[model samples]
Target: MDITCDFNTLPKNGHYKPLLEKEELKTQLLLNIRSCLSYLFPNGTFHGNEYRIGNLQGSKGKSLRVELTGNKAGLWNDFATGEGGDIIDLWAAAHRKDVKAEFHEVMASIGEWLGYYRQHKVNEAESTISWDYLDENGEAIVKVYRYDTALGKRYLPFDVKKSSYTAPEVRPLYNIPGIIKADKVIIVEGEKCAESLIKQGITATTAMSGANAPIDKTDWSPLKGKHIIIWPDNDEPGKQYAEKVAKKLIDLGVISLATVKIPQDKPIAWDAADCIQEGTNPLEFITNRKSPYHNNNSSNKLKKIDTSIWTNTAPERKWIIKDWLPVGSVTAVYGDGGVGKSLLAQQLMTAAAIGKSWLGIDIEQIKTYGVFCEDDEEELWRRQCTINAFYQLDMQSPAFLDNICLSSRVGENNLLMVFDNKGIGQLTPYFQELLADIELFQPKLVILDTAADLFGGNENDRSHVRQFIQNCCGHIAKTIKGAVLLCAHPSDSGIIRKTGTGGSTAWNNSVRSRWYLSKPDRADASDIDRVLCRKKSNYSASEQNQISFYWQNGAFVECNAHFNSERIVRNNYNKKLDLERGRRHDVILELIASEAYKGKVYTTAQFAKYFEGKLGLGSERSIRERISHLATIGHIKFFKRSPEHELSNTRSKYGYLCVEDMELKISEDQYVFIKPSCYLSATNGVLMPVENPNVWVTHNFIINDNFKLAE
Candidate 1:
């Protein structure tokens, strides 16, 4: 049976010591398994490592699911619940208790049970020895001992019986008095070596967890200012542990330190105890083999600045999509549904599949790959046909078709299995196979159609989001030396802040570039006009802020990039402005204000009658929309007169008001306009409402400089 290395591999020559011998720990911890069969599973049977405790709770009456397998090592595996670990881990899972909370109690119980069993075995027939660890005042702190059994060797406390096995929480030096008074101390790997060295009038000690324990786990202050010698085991782990311990000692302000490498031909774990038994003079060897400590590991040294390598000008960066996607980096393209995110990606892919310019940027027909989790192969193929028809090229020709590969139905495929739901990500074998297939293609740019479909985790969770990026997309991009464009949707995108994309900041922060695509309102243009706003760019010196495209010639063309749709609306409105319409709107508002000033209420029809033949709009739909637009701005208010009518009854008459005139109680509804603040010029040269008949407080906050608010 093989034993796990607790700290590092043990050394020879009586120079190294550790807490428990691996053989001993294995006998006590692994071989002598605790039998709780009758208690946990009534009328159940136990045979060797396989204990058939019937089926689990919900899975009762099925195959014997509640079976434990002592996996030869000091651990058990649960095939039913997919859990495996030490005895304590099994105990926690079996009883559905918090593992962390039950750790201390579990350890204590295991220790006690093992002690009892070891005592029983020893009483039958065994040989053992016990030693007492004393404090500085000569009081006994702990009793350490070892015993041999049929399984092998075991170690435990002397007072093991009905009382719980009390292990010291704060491990003191084996010989506290000798260690405190001695100016020069030798630190070994375990207690046995310390005890052996002490018997030879040498002050020596070892940490509680021996070489396995981290530096923070020990109270290293006791060794301060003492000249120390660390003698490690003659193995790989021992040498590494020696280096670590030396570093910790140096960090803890050791006055001086050195190490001794003992040459040995014995097998691993043959330590100081074996050396003494073999009659080797370890004290002489320690003196002869001592050498100054050298922390040769580069990781142990503080990071130093390297100013020798300098550049006078910025190095040129390779581009996948001229100011947007860069090679060997990550970029995100996000938008609301049907704003041409997929279509735009298809167009770009088509450009890369053939040697063509995209958005005026030329490409050399590099390899292109697309993974659309939301779309199936048929839909993706249809999109391919669209791309071919739009470009008027036989893209299905062997050359271009061979260069581009499109994968769909990804959610159905086993790809999502790679990115686990938990934050701790691990790539699966299936995923590696997929990556291998992608490697065969060697695509320069990979497009993840939608993040939500590709990532099988809570997008809102920062850990999960970062895990998906770092362990999935980021890993692929870095591994393949290519660019990755992740597609996502915004939360009420056009109306909400571009940063509010329904996830943690890591979604945006982790990517190097991001973009937003939105359709322009039909009132200002046609339904096919889309504005691609560059939301973020880290690599570009000058960002392509907004790229507008029309769905003309069957594809996205950058003939006229719309910088600001709201600004265009304003300019068009100004060019078509008529004094009659402005005067009529003013008169309607003034009339409402005049009536409200006299505490009199007016209706929409009454206001429309006054503006009849005085404005271009002829129907009530146009007239009401004007009033709603006015009310949408802070200029007017439309509501029901009282909450009593609204709260007590659904059937109630709605009212209107000129806000500055009187305290007209009302509630806002669809009748109220929802316009974003944009200004326009009136004959009076004061800023007036642009009256966008179709504006929401969306991407339209730019105010006109020539127009001031109505005082």
Candidate 2:
């Protein structure tokens, strides 16, 4: 056997302590065997360096012979030697304390020595040094020994590789008189954390040296669900390193992970020694530390989003509300009147009824039966026919009709159509019922065609409308883990309005995504030639471009951009009103109050009725004129209906009032007239709802003189 790097490879007279003769021999023998076996059986099994020493073998027969294999091939010749041959000389040379040959070479060389004995008619004998050294196959098993240089004695195998194996050097620490069983396991970066924790009655272990130390796989198995608290250094790397280890514990099923954010201004705390020296109580820190997992759960609670509801007890992952549909979000799809918004909405509902993809968005289409409060069934069916013909979609596909739900075959929510369910109080129960059906369908998306029919009475009530939309969106997004695309009509001229139909900005305010469709110049060019502007978003990038869709007979096909108007409508109103630059900032509060009071009766007394406890203005006259000026700017509209005054049963209270144009106005009598509030301000005098405390006058115009107060 050729042993590698003996004492000769070390410095001759350095302070290095050389191995003893016996230890050297054992190390050489094992290294040679390992080196040879590793090369021969790279993938095949070979036990670790430790083994049991087996019996010595010698055979004497007429024609029996043995040869060397692997690295020991050059150790011996083909034939045995005797008498004049150099057999004795070579044997004496091979058995020297310093000489090393491969295990196979040594075996072959021994066989040659025996062959020499046979040629000379020497006697053969068999003896075993150890009883457990040989297997049934007569192969020699090696026994491993550790050299105790301190005592200069070889000890038996320690079985240190076991799960309970404590370092022999470090065992005395555990035997200390003051040692106590700690209620918590304090995991630290190094041995110092363990020592620091031990000082504080915490049983702890440093993950060896750093975060990357080797961990015993079996040792970690018992730690699952154990309370493991980690303290990282007050730096990015330390926090990241600690999180890495915590994740490993989590993967192995640890109870939870808590992080103690270290403030950077404090003295640097890299390891346990520093922490202890700085009087940092690692145990207390861990006990009081906020768990990242717990914080996440608590934050989710506020939005009524529960991740653990689906993660903890469920066999399969439960859908969280956030994953299904984000709270405070809106999603919309806009196209021309005849551009197939209804058809697409139906297809999406159908696809959601049977989990499938529409236009490449992965969604589980529920068995969605829409209520046709607006459209007739024939129109709906006609659209469906056109859709099927366009996409050549087979209705027989399992992805077509698994859990389909319908409210009305006419494609809408029927209850809302009849009852005008605009408030969350009224809509929640309805949505919950719909959600129950949606879950059965396991839909990933729902369709509410043209929001006008949905928020019937209070369509202009953005706050109320948004609350309802959020409830519906939240339920659908969470229960079925789906999305809701509410269809809405554009203004009469097809101009993009904040409120899609019924003109409530809240319609767009509550959706997560909003896609505005503009009329294509050439309708015949392609049904898909309309511009889709991503006017709002939370997840997707905000982009505006013309996306082409081709109405191939009846179905719409999305294609690569063939026509792009690349139009950017700068909302000057928004840009000018940004308070940061202070350009039109003075008007921000006015604009906000006007928007808040949108679509409501604005008589002086009614203003008090609407904003008594809310409007914090001192001068009522100024507030009224502010309303009048806002109306003049087209931000609001004032009306005087002939019989409008009696609608609220407060006849001629102010004789005329302002309301959002979209609001249905009822006239009571000829005396109760309905005209723009601007007409009242123009013909009679401005109605003052409040007064300004700090009034100013310019060279050209005086504040209170130019406009008189209305009676």
Candidate 3:
């Protein structure tokens, strides 16, 4: 807050007494009295016409109430402290100063805060001319002071009650008393023009700040039922001002409205002031050129479409990410908590900025802007570190910093659209600032992380959600000629249905593209595995569009990495099958060894039949195949034994035996063996050479040995 004022230009003596007595200035202060209270009590909340706060300490409570509207606009009272005052007195009290003791300093400080510069010299050419704004009682409300300097003419408002020079937040119309009495009123661009017309016995009024008046903040209710004629200066800005005022007046339900168009032949910016100076009656001139205004919505004609244009081939559609997010449209990325939506969005923005692929998906390389409302600067720094590592990029490199712009609005008021008292959605001032930044940056992609924070309306309301997406986000996308990716959390039902939508169906319907990131739902899926599905797409096929990613190196990598190779897949399957076979082999060998020890050995066919119902091991044929393979590898040995009899007559049958219980020999040409220093053991009846018993051999090896195998 820099004060652009020359303090030396002010009178040394206490000549400020007269300045404080200007009643018109008091009215201006009262008009914007709400803002004044808010400034003094930053923690306060507005309840209808009053701003409520805890106490003078600015705590969060409703003990102090400051009137914001009507005749009591500047009045304030503290119920607990039993203290009260007008807006000026409140300002002084907030600063811990007595109004009378430190009047000059307080007034100067207040003026500076309200965008006023206190420079008044006695020079005739640089003299300040002010016109008082009067209320319906003919009492002064505020005064607009105009100073003609060498550079240009500058105006500063003087608030009488505050004893300072500052404009009101909501300015009153000049000559309100005159407007209340007149049935037909003339609206001019500046107070000087209105005063010029008023001198000629004409009913005229103007909003403060001339052509740049805050049309939304100005009180226009005074002319609600009056017939109004807008007298615009002969210039482009003035014409636009006239159109804006006409629209507002129509919305205000005025009786009738018209515009007095200045002749093109007249010099630029010629107005009622010029007419008055030229000795011409401004009203007479305006009366000759005025025309009734019609609302644009009143047209009933339907626009005809030309099908002939369809003969030409349409241009190819543009995309920020192919088949996922189209250019100049809104895309929503929804996910459950901790699904890495924000991280994914950040990586996408970074990849787009640096002309790299994001999770194996090709992205358009362009300037990008990111608004991460949930993460603060420190958190973003940590995330960027990991993302940089994944991309093998230097964070400070020009390739990254030059093309990427990021903002963290954690713990900040990030609402872009808010519903007014009338339930109509209006873009907030902060939103305008964002648009301004986007216009300057001209980014090709904008990522607003998490919709719950930026959207200020009800999420369940379809209209509010639709308006927010199409108006706020869509407008930004259109302005930048790119894409706006809004990140959001999925609703409970959306999560259950795997649609990744939240609140109203409009969240899915309104966006041109919708993507969902969720943990893989398959039984064998890893915890780190995630699947990004295109739930909806308007310009591209989405039914089979999905990408699989695995969390690695602090960032998500396409599952198509080395882990997804065909060779790796085959090896993994083979390894699992081998483990299952080993377990079954151990079961068979232990059964055989136990049966032989009990002198009740069974034949291979009997063993196979016995295992048929014992294990979930497939069909009996499959079990025979496994048994034959094990025997072929010499893991099982067979012996002819005296078989049993059910009725005392028996025949000898071949019985199964564990190889560990039999002496074995192997030909040198048929088998290769490790050094004898490595001990041999029958692992599941398969002799495996264990170089050190402490380290078990995972693979089987055949060996020629004359000694009995160790159990």
Candidate 4:
């Protein structure tokens, strides 16, 4: 939201002119033009080489076009209003500000969008400081630079070896050389805090990213045998960081570890820098406040639960989808490949985002995030269009886009956890970045598509699978106080058993709820019909364990028979028979019509042969029976035609014809037979077809006592 920039150090005549003229900056902006435009106009969509939207007012239309590729990238035009400019000008218009009058502010906003602070060139001596992180051989590997600007302090890591502003995945600690020779090293939150202690002849160091540094990514081997002391700032995050560092150090086999707890009366965020600024002795301060940390895992003590607290009222359970996904837990939906699992998951998140129904099940509407490893951005975009149509929602609405966040990692390293050299599962930097993003967005539901791509460990290893789910995915779910719906592919046995689970049973046991999406098992079922079976549910009833759906409009829609177990069981046999008969009728009618159109006719036997093993219509005998039944019902007719070779004295052949193409007359004496279940009207003595012919009904009228049908 802050759009102002510091132009005090620049020439008054052309503030931010330098930034605008920088070719490198322009190139970077163009490289990420799609993301920039998305941030500026959340309602816009990328179409081909251009991003389209209504106008700068963020409306939903294609009148405004912003080039997303080639030399004309970042250029845009609004055809409806006859207005156009570069990306910066578009940003100004989006914010309803004058470009020329607010150039500095515009540059600042752009800089913020690009993930940086916009400050005009300043005197290096007055506004910046640099600290070099040396390797074991005392050579500079990376340098951490700090800049004091009008906005706030900014830190950037520069890779000395690569000569680039980008930092390495695993960065070295600050003052590594200073801590290598010393047996006792003091760790602080920031470089300034470390330097404050170092000035007092103490061996002090810190990680590159302060309290937010990745503990697993940072090298702590240099202090493997040294006595470590962590001086945390007077804040909760700082304390947590210190605890994390201490645990990592203990794992590294450190000689000892301790934490320096600030006094209760100390101001918030007080650190060693402030301590030294107050003229306090740094060494004395550490010695006085240090509390030794102990790894108490060796003790066999267990804490007992207090039952006295049970007298109080219990908290009610919450759910993302009632009885499907409980809050603050990990739920899994597994299926075979190409079973529309991804599309189903996407629709669920979209429903939550737009407050719509998914498969006729209402969901808790909230912010949602999706990490799709198999799908690309274009594929997701195409899917989104169909989903929008199904939900009758505008994809370009700000509320829709803001509530949903999506990422496509098709060909990227999407591993959230990987085995290190020691064969221990460790979180990758990418996972850390994901956690940061989720924390920032605070989404209530996170969907990770297809575990085949994201899970890096051995699927057969029960320990690895459990750890990945509970420790990694479960942590994320707990952090957001919501549920994580993970998509997975079933194994060979899993498919055979129709359980929608694979690998170790741990995969099924680890998640709180595991549902399997698969096609219907019935031989006469439609190909588009899918069944989501609840194989494991810790929080739901067993009666309604499955839901049937039919694929429609690129998403799944609930079938009419969903959750009707009693009715389904009662009419199972009749339903299958009726469905098979209907299928056979369709096949026979289609073949007859096509052959008639081609000036060719086939007998009932020939049609039966053609229908063999087709549409699962059963054997030749069953097919013939179906044809005979259709003829009996007046849906088909038998026709006699002479052969082409009249000289041979061949007898006339009979072939089937669609009844609609023929005209016939029937006398009043002809009787039209009806099903036995039909009821006779009491008022007019007219027979009426039963609504459900398969279900027998008791009628009061008795036309004849001898007219009886078997139940």
Error of 3 at 648 (Å): 82
Expressed as tens digits, the lDDT of each residue in 136-201 for candidate 4 is: 788999877665646567666678887766567788998887887898888899888888888888
Q: After superposition, how far is residue 221 of candidate 3 from its true place, in Å?
A: 6.9
Each prediction's number of clashing residue pairs: 8, 70, 5, 0
> What ordering of candidates by TM-score runs from best to worst?
3, 4, 1, 2
lDDT, candidates in the order shown:
0.58, 0.42, 0.71, 0.71
Give the TM-score of each candidate. Answer: 0.41, 0.34, 0.47, 0.46
- Give the per-residue lDDT of model 3 (tens digit) for 1-711: 333323324545322223432233355467567667777888999899889999888899999998887657788899998999888788888889897877656666776565444443223355567799878888777877775644467666876555566666677898898898898888998988998889899999998887899899899999876678788888999989998887787566454566766666789999889978998776556543242222221111123456876856888899988888899899999999998999999999899999999988777679999999999999999999999999999988898998999999999899987764544555665776788787798899999987998898988665788778987898799888999999999876456435565665567669999888998655466788898977678899644557878898778998664666774475657645644554466456545544543344454566677778575566666566555554544455444322231212224232333333221113322211111112223344443333442221222443323233221
Worst lDDT 10-window in candidate 3: 668-677
Across residues 524-557, which tens digit of lDDT does each residue of candidate 2 receive? 3333444344444566432322344545566555
Q: Is candidate 1 or candidate 4 better by TM-score?
A: 4
Model 1 error, position 342 (Å):
1.1
TM-score quality measure for candidate 1: 0.41
Point to the candidate with the largest TM-score: 3
Q: What is the lDDT of residue 164 in candidate 4?
A: 67
lDDT of 4: 0.71
Model 1: ten consecutive residues of lowest lDDT = 293-302
Clashing pairs in 1: 11-233, 11-234, 14-272, 17-189, 17-190, 18-190, 632-673, 687-708
